[model samples]
Target: MDNMFVLGIMVVGAFLIQSALGFFQIKHFGNEYNELKAEGRVAIGKRAGKLTSGTIIMFLLDDEGVIVRGKKLQGTTILARFKPYDKFKGKYIGAITAEDSEMIAEIKITRNTVMNAVNNYKMFINGEAIPEKGSPFAELVKKIKNI
Candidate 1:
């Protein structure tokens, strides 16, 4: 009877710990988001949790929205794509688009290929240089660009 009671207490303790951690994480991210919004940074998209260590990095885009791949999104231009590396771990690529370039729409192809598609796709999109010619990632990037 004492063992069972101990086991139940342990479970409850673990649950409370997890809940506390989750609450703090949400509060932290929420404050950061609100600050970004106040700074006029608009979010394009984001990926978080698990692989990202619960780091919610928002892909902040330019208000003007520049073109990258020669395609238009409805009425706004196709600005450069952005992706975060990991929680507080800098980024894989810094700049997605140049200061003043007239490209088109940038495509990020993330499907069943090499590790997590989200990270892989963002790496390609924000990579300093394109992947090598015949590599699988290169092939994926080619297909996305062509489309």
Candidate 2:
């Protein structure tokens, strides 16, 4: 009975420590984000990938799709949920300020079936096919290109 009581105390202690850590993380990053917003900077895109050590790397892209400005934060995680944007390296995504650089909140363009079809068509035609004007896919492509 004594051993079980001790185990319960230890478990509760661990949970409390975890809760404190999470609270601190939010306080720190939230302040940083608010400061950036006040300055009128936006984040265009976010990319997170693996680092050599246990540390994960995250980058914030500006409007021109450049990784010039971002808050660099280090966190311990075995694997990051973010996947690398492989479609095009250095693609032009329009003017994102530093305020848009929150690690937890990012706009991700999910590829749907229509997007896949368009990509497959592009590949088949050797990348030379004009999407029909006023088509939904064409509008989507335009928006992405403008981003």
Candidate 3:
């Protein structure tokens, strides 16, 4: 019947359009991944000769015995070494260490406490711990709102 034929054609057309959209989405994600990798490499290079670790929750940058958070990370661990990837040559961005079991609990606790403080807007920035003026994040928000 003509109705059946038209329905079949419509179904096939819809399938093809969905397939194309999925393909484009994958391509876009791949491009974004590559860009992030490049930026990560650059950041690492600038901080080379320094010990660094990357986890799902945060990035640790250890330079001259000082440890600081470089990026927001999930899991915490001391990095054993770096492995160079073929795609990212000279970029020792990949960690070769097993996850630190001991630090896992601590990291989670810290993350939760920090999240709570942030959510409650109870974190301090400068000398004072007031609700508004003491938080750098609040200042940033105010500046953004003004802009």
Task: Please report the candidate that would top lDDT against the real structure.
Answer: 2
Q: Model 3: per-residue lDDT, tens digit, 49-132?
A: 113332221223232212232332222233222322222122222321123332243444433432332223222222444333
Could you give candidate 2's per-residue lDDT for residues 1-147 as a string of tens digits?
Answer: 999999999999989988887677667656666755565433322223224222212233344334433443433442223233323223322322223333124323221221322243334346565433355567789899999
How does model 3 score by TM-score? 0.30
The C-alpha local distance difference test score for the whole of candidate 1 amounts to 0.37
Model 3 pairs whose backbones collide: 56-74, 57-72, 57-73, 57-74, 57-75, 58-72, 58-73, 58-74
All candidates: TM-score: 0.41, 0.40, 0.30
Off by over 4 Å in 3: 41-147
The per-candidate count of clashes, in order, stands at: 6, 14, 8
Q: Cα deviation of 24 in candidate 2 (Å)?
A: 0.8
- Looking at model 1, the pairs that clash are 68-104, 69-104, 69-105, 70-104, 70-105, 71-105
Candidate 3's clash total is 8
Candidate 1: minimum summed lDDT over ten consecutive residues — where?
67-76
Clashes, model 2: 14
lDDT head-to-head 1 vs 2, winner: 2
Where is model 2 poorest over a 10-residue stretch in terms of lDDT? 107-116
- Reference-based lDDT, each prediction: 0.37, 0.41, 0.36
